[model samples]
Target: MTVPDYPRPPFKPQQQSFPGKTDKMDPRPDHGEDSYVGHGLLAGKKALITGGDSGIGAAVAIAFAREGADVAIVHLPTEEKDAQRILELVKKAGVDGVALACDISDPELAAKTVESVAERFGRIDVLVNNAAYQKYYESMEEITLEEWTKHFNTNVHAPFNLVRLALPHMQEGASVINTASVQSKKPSPNILPYAATKGAIANMTVGLAGLLAEKKIRVNAVLPGPIWTPFIPAGMAPEEVETFGEQTPFKRPGQPVELASAYVMLAADTSSYTSGALLTVSGGAATL
Candidate 1:
């Protein structure tokens, strides 16, 4: 049979959703939701995470919850259902979890949400800027003006707004983590706009690290490789989905669970001295 998009040990079968789902996706994401062990590293902290509905954001929420921090999730309407599930998971981990439904593409919505979360939590100690959007094209000819702007708005503009709005409310020990991609390290013909924005995120992380140093705030970026996230099923060729991580040395896509540890480290004082760096988690692919 012809290869299918992102088959685990079998063919694509019939279970598929554009952008996919952790709850509905067969062989659901291995989030290790039940295995996280928090040592109160982030105890009493209040954190805001954008796109906290699924994948890395969801994993980070679970980790942060276990670490004893109340979490606020900022997500779009399409992500509302997953965001609700994430709140439940976070509460189960024993931390306060609130889901805010708003179009992150709107700058005012971001400011208001962060402001309210900061007010309710009394202070914001950690901010995770992890929202993203991607519209792939086979060639430049296939990309439209509207798609180009949408890519920048969601992928870069939203995080930029979050960082700006959340910065003032953050404390001395606050941390800001941005979601970048391995595509930032190299160009992909199939995802020009996505690769461009991810690269911008990487550079922006470094720039913010330097800019926020005087405030004692840290900024960093995570460069994820081919992870089995919903973004793939929703954003790429069907054939590409079938062979998601074949190019990686491991011959398989990395899981979201594998990414939470570093996040925990960076969030806590464990990586206090580290800032403006890129953490690569791409199944052995080297960073740029």
Candidate 2:
């Protein structure tokens, strides 16, 4: 079946009470299941992606696998089914795929996840620190201190732990790609904490790029506008979900596969000079 292009909302009103389980999605978000074609851009590479069971991480896993890379994804234990599906897709590409289950917010578990992957693969070529936690709040009173701290722990601290643990396994020519958001520049009132972490990720990408340049490791970020993923309907209201991407100039949200090429470029050898860059994959969402 041909997936329709953007500008039209293509899904029904469906929601998952919790994150993970891509199969529960209404339209079953397209992870280039039949469309994305690879060209050996990342051959012989080993990649570790947090939250790789679904959404953008799943899309990247499939793309990297097709391009000839062995993939190790970290996801919550509840996401085993979704991780199984991604593993199947990676295997189809004739590459190895391993899925590790753990809550990345735990610094010790996060470090161990990276170590396991590095041990299995011998080294890490790509590290995508994409796992995040988000919740909608109407007012400052509605947001608890624990909630705020949890967001930082999962969204910010987990990335830091993973990077530190993986750095020793990363050599020259390695790439670290972070998933930032259009919210990084333009904050959405409802999801303040999530947006704040995205801003931090973008800033860290630039600073880390310079820090890692001496080691010849590239650090970059992808600033996505609004993509049609479980994150949307799961986080927003039913009415908001119905009109999800209407605010964008494209009048629709981007698909997971649409952002695949940007990730591929950053992870590939061709983007060796593309460190510290913020590649916006927003469908006409304005970014400064």
Candidate 3:
């Protein structure tokens, strides 16, 4: 299919508080609501995604449902409206769908969320660790210890905890997909804390792939570059948001729907031989 002409910047200047609402975005992100079509790639599978309320996670949820997987998406309590909308789309694909409200930064909460999903689905064939925390800071002095820790907790530690908690439900042929970032290799000083966490996630993905190889499970990560999502407005300055993805050769940020197929390919049974891979989805940008 021909790629649709996705919106390009300079976007209308906008800003939002942490955990931005989808309805608030100017051109809005496309979570494959009308475009994505499936062909039973994951029929009868059960998958769980963190931060599935908006952005990449939501798109993956929609794609997974269309592909015939039962999906449970995790989101913060404050994102219920967005979560519900995604869940509605998921169910519309004629599969089981649920929205789990939990702050995965807390180990206990993360564990409970895993247990709840496992109980509801009976098994987890796919785990997508997509939730993340990021905020741009002009200098190191502007980043506090609390903010630094929050980044690790939400981005790194939470994925680690979820993997540990969800493994029991995952068996042979299961897949684990982490959302690493181009920032992992090409770090930006402004969001150093977030970049650092993504670096850790990329490393963790490789390590876990090795460790889980004996169990016949595949582990991988997707390093996305400058996607147009609620994350931009929420984590960036209004001025920065206006020109979000101009640095890329594409001259625009990607839409959330654009990353859907990467997640689907990683989770599908056909990719059984794929593991320890960091698939970069940046539009014409190079990463180490």
Give RMSD (Å) of candidate 1 vs. truth: 4.2
Candidate 3 accuracy as TM-score: 0.99
User: Which of the numbered candidates is closest to the native, going by highest TM-score?
Assistant: 3
Give me the overall lDDT of model 2: 0.87
Ranking by lDDT: 3, 2, 1
The lDDT of each candidate is 0.82, 0.87, 0.95
lDDT of 1 by residue, 1-288 (tens): 232233353325333444456666555775557667788998888998887888888888888998999999877777789999889988987788899987788988877898889888888888888878876578888988888888899889888888888877888989999989888988788999989999999999999999999999999988888877777776777777777777888777877777887788888877888899898888797665
What does candidate 2's lDDT look like per residue over 123-238, in tens digits?
Answer: 99999988888777778888888988988998888887788889999999999999989989998888899899999999999999999999999999999988877788777767
Residue 236's lDDT within candidate 2 is 70
Tell me the tens digit of each residue's lDDT in model 3 across 1-288.
788998888999888988888999999899999999999999999999999999999999999999999999999999999999999999999999999999999998898999999999999999999999999898889999999999999999999999999999999999999999999999988889999999999999999999999999999999999999888998888888999999999999999999999999999999999999999999998777
Error of 1 at 23 (Å): 3.2
Q: How many steric clashes between backbone atoms does each model show?
A: 5, 0, 0
Candidate 2, poorest ten consecutive residues by summed lDDT: 1-10
TM-scores for all candidates: the values are 0.93, 0.96, 0.99
